[model samples]
Target: MRLSVLDRSRVRAGSGHPEALRDTVAFARQAEQLGYHRFWVSEHHGVPGVAGSAPTVLAAAVAAATSRIRVGTGGVMLPNHQPLVVAEQFGVLESLFPGRIDMGLGRSVGFIEAVRKALGHDQEDAADFGRGLAELLGYFTGDRAVRGYPADGLRVPPFVLATGAGARVAAAHGVPLVIGSFRGEDAMIDAITAYRAGFRPSTWAEEPYVVISSTVAVADTAEDAWRLLVPEAWAMAHSRTRGDFPPLSAPDDVLAQPMTSRERGLFEQSLRGHVHGTPSEVAKALDHLVHRTAADEVLVTTSTYDRAAMLDSYRLLAGLYL
Candidate 1:
């Protein structure tokens, strides 16, 4: 099984964006050493906990810092920028990194209305994602009326960040699909099936390829692994209630906080499908998940309050299959 990373460059409670970004670069190097196939950075605009607003920039840093490991976005939200500009930026990255760059694009609007306005985007912009993606691809393949300059001759492997409509867009374009299903297993299977059924044979890919991204953590004990997930889960719950995604707190701190019934419900919802346990247990669940989803690769998107423990979890998970 091919294991990859999708790092959000998460800012912990006490750490700032600089520390989180530095950790992203350092973690990419470690991931390469640990035999991860690809390292992807995600883009989240106006989020306090996430520092990866500009994934292409972060991808460039990661690519410069590490060799051999494929570096790219997990992805760049396409509606946030013009297609030509997106093409040019990735074109430059591909020129710098050559065969090691992946252009993963998504169709998400900003997290909130203010953020959407700041990006000069709205829900209507998301409606034009397919058209934007087509334009982006045309620039790469040199098939459009407009040119992408340095990117014209480049062959950056494009993958769509799979959401509901995004999966179909990937199928229509014959690019790979990267879906995050940390909520349910059945949903992942349905997405893959839909992609395969609608996939067209384009030069980009002859057949459908799927990459599943999920929260995975491994520790010496099952209980300990669950402990490592608490911070992030609590953060998710907090986001639902407060309309802001806060930086992760310590697991003990999260656990000690009093919760209302609604908060408790949301917290439990966040915990679903988070594959955390001992190595053997996590391995078994991941195997089942990969098989069920027919995933060509699995992207581990694990974030925890404990940075050292996060590294250990990746190391152990890598040992299990890498």
Candidate 2:
């Protein structure tokens, strides 16, 4: 199975956004060296914890920093931008990087009502994602009335970052589907089965391709690996209860804090679905997950406060599969 990475450019408690973004670029170079298939970045608007707001721009930095390995967005939310503009931006990326670029698209609007208003979109705009996707694809194929200059004939591969009705949209459009594994195995498998059953052949993809996006952490011991997940879990729990996502704190520090019943519940819940263990243990879990889902690729999206530990976890994971 293909092993890839999706870095959210998450900021650490002591770090700034600039450092977070630079770390992403540097991480991409390291990922290429580790024999990873793809190194993709994410987009999060006005989120304090996430530094990767402009994915295409960040992708350019990553591409320039690495000679090999596919680079793309985990995704750019279609509801927040014009389809034509999205096409053109990707076109320029394809023009520069050629076969190395992947255009991963999502249907999400901004995180909150105010942010959505600032982006000139509402929740209802997500319903128009299917139409926007069609228009974006049309720009590359010359099927639309207005043609995008560099994009008209460029064959940049498109992948749908599946959420909610995303699998259906991907099936109709005949593109690869990138779906998370956090939602529960049965639900994810059902979505994949439905997507394949409804898939229609198109120039982008003749067959249904599924990439299971999951958080995986590997270390010398199972306990150490589990510790690596603590910071991010706390951040997620904090976001749910506090209305804002803060930077990752040290796992030890996070563990020391007293939590309310709600925070504790959410924090523990955040840690449950992820795969975290020693190298051998993690290998078995990942193998089983891939087998169960029949996934074409495994996109690792692990994050932590300890940069060294995070890198070590990735190295151990790469040793297992690469």
Candidate 3:
């Protein structure tokens, strides 16, 4: 039952991107002191709400700031960059951090068509993820046609951030799988089952490893914990409805806004499928979730407008296990 964090470097309303990024680095230091297993960052291109556009660079900053906790990306989307460049970037990281770096890879392209074009990729490019993954792995193993400098013979653990089909890719590659819990329990279970069924032994992993990424908010009261989810939920709703993801707003501000039926529905939907409650309640839900999915680790990915409250939520969650 390992507990980890995946901070998106979320930009809060009234704050600049620099502050949000500095917050992430500072948050990693706190997370390390709190005894978390890993502290991972994320990548989002052209998303206003997310300041972590370059996860590898952010990961380096986090590693430099912390002593023990593992540092890596929640992931870097493979389709947007050349595998060789990605390998070199991580090669430099692993060389610097040694055993503390992880490579979490994802297949997602940019969020919108314009951003996708800017990245020189489109939706269809995501399908090439399998090929790209192989190339990236080959660099580390020195199995590719070209050598990847410091990357060759470097053994940085790789984890695939996947859904159903992506889970199959992870299984085929025989690396660890990092799946989200947002998509309903049944669907998540099915994906895990498929992943285990198709898993093959490779240098990366001898058996299937599953890390369930989830939104977990803990507080003194159930209502208070639920309130921590509001800002991100509203931002998600805004992205879906208005096609723009704004910085996180205070819970009170979000609650006071008038919304169309569609916006309201999406906002409500975003709030569901999370583990939020008092410490005891959240623990119970997480225990059940781990039991059902047989997850090797739990990656907490909770963001809110209030930084202090957010850190308190993580502190409470860490207290449950540490």
Best by lDDT: 3
Candidate order by decreasing lDDT? 3, 2, 1
Candidate 1, residues 1-322, lDDT tens digits: the string is 9999999999899889999999999999999999999999999999888899899999999999999999999899999999999999999999988999999899998999999999999999998999999999999899988889889989999999876788889999999999987647777678788899999989899999999988998999998999998988998998889988888899999889999999999998888778889999999999988778778999898899898999999999999999
Cα RMSD to native, each candidate? 1.0, 0.7, 0.6
lDDT digits (tens) for residues 1-322 of candidate 3: 7999999999999998999999999999999999999999998999887899999999999999999999999999999999999999999999999999999999999999999989999877799889999999999999999999789999999999999899999999999999999999999999999999999999999999999999999999999999999999999999998787899999999999999999999999999999999999999999999999999999998899999999999999999997
Misplaced by over 4 Å in model 2 are none
- Name model 3 segments beyond 4 Å from true: none
User: What Cα-based lDDT does every candidate model obtain?
Assistant: 0.91, 0.93, 0.95
Rank list by TM-score = 3, 2, 1
Q: Deviation in angstroms for 200 in model 3?
A: 0.4
- Candidate 2: 10-residue stretch with minimal lDDT: 109-118
Candidate achieving higher lDDT, 1 or 2? 2
On residues 152-261, what C-alpha lDDT tens digit does candidate 2 reach at each position? 99999999998558899999999999999899988999999999999999999989999999999999999999999999999999999997789999988999999999
User: How do all models score by TM-score?
Assistant: 0.98, 0.99, 0.99
